[model samples]
Target: MEKRNDPQLRLGEEFFNQPCLSLAKAFLGKVLVRRYADGTELRGRIVETEAYLGGEDRASHSAGGKRTERNTAMFMKPGTIYVFPIYGILLCMNVSSEGEGAAVLLRSLEPLRGQTLMRELRAARRKEGAPQLKDKDLSNGPAKLCQALNILRCFDRRDLASDPDMWMEREPDTNPAEPHDIVSAPRVGVESHGEWAEKPWRFYLRGNPCVSVVNKDAERQSGSVTDNVRSLTCAV
Candidate 1:
């Protein structure tokens, strides 16, 4: 993948917060701008997010006394990236560290960068009988978001507050949508928890098409993206 022509933004402490779920909700409809030092800007509208707390949140990777080199960043300061692969696909992107060791799982994004490249990527997914892209389709699911942005495991645990290579920026022109306009749904996968899995923490913009429609579109069976988009660690 080629480096994007985006300019870099100065990340700050205010971007970091404890108990990242509230911040995740607040992040909705907000622009997460990324600018490379070269001066180009790439933007995305956050659409879906989930919260995870250390050793407490049963649904979290760090839950139930689990810890490893992979989850170490979840115990660091706020504003760190926690990226990993799942199901031999989908490079899930997470925001690590909030109040002791809580994290926000970045489930999906509405892309705003590398327009041509993003479209091409989406086109490949579409020809496979998957969802198509307009502007909003550029980045929806976690893996897709990273794909559109050229994000990788190298970004994992990087201090977003200090890293010039990658950091989130605020867009002054964000239009806040009403809470009622927000849609709440059970998270995708992770259904084995029985009742706890039904919590509505997973959120997305009600009308955004960048969101992954696996469950919603499974009946039609028209959505099929490349299971192995990219993930050096994922087995082939």
Candidate 2:
């Protein structure tokens, strides 16, 4: 994949050098770009993300400051890619943020380019008898977006700021999401982590159809907790 010549469009280190929670919110409305070896470019609008506060985040892979071969990317500098497997076969993509081992999980994306290719890639991964995927379902979840974008374990540890094959860019046509347009709620699939599971660490664009899940009750309950968690985690 060739590097994009327009440096102005690609996000730099400064964009990612923020606290995990801040980065998670900031990711909303941004554009994630992936370039294939054949020069096929796939683009998506980031719609949902989750923050993991490193050693203090019990649900994080690097919980208790524990490091392993699989999770070293979480300890890397901001903008480092952290691709990890789930359910033994599927993968999820995250980006390291400020603080030791802290990272932001990219929970969902709205496909903006290469829809046909994204659908093809996704279909290739489905079982032979599985139903065909609709456009709305192409990249609307963590592992689903990975499949749509062809994000494999080999992408782990790459620098999103400099990687030729993959990078993030600001949304060229839209303003950054206003606070009122961003929804905060507890992260998904982390209930086993005790109280940490209830932290309002997951963020998404309000009313975005591509978001993986929309929990209205959770959002209503998270108002105060969101402010508390923000004060603790947004200090950078």
Those runs of model 2 whose alpha carbons end farther than 4 Å from true positions after fitting are 1-5, 221-236
Full-model lDDT, candidate 1: 0.66
Give one digit per residue, the lDDT tens place, for model 2 in 1-236.
Answer: 34453688789999999999999999999999999878889989999999999998999999999999999999999999999999999999999999999999999999988999999999899899888887779999999999999998999999999999999999667788987678888999999999999998999887888999998976665555667778888885
Listed in order, each prediction's TM-score against the native is: 0.75, 0.90
In the order shown, the candidates' Cα RMSDs to the true structure are 12.0, 5.0
Tens digits of per-residue lDDT, candidate 1, 109-223, equal 7776657766665575455765656676577677777767667787788887777666666555555665644565667676986765876667666667776653443222211
For model 1, name the residue pairs that clash.
6-36, 6-40, 7-35, 7-36, 7-40, 8-35, 8-36
Best lDDT among the predictions, by candidate number = 2
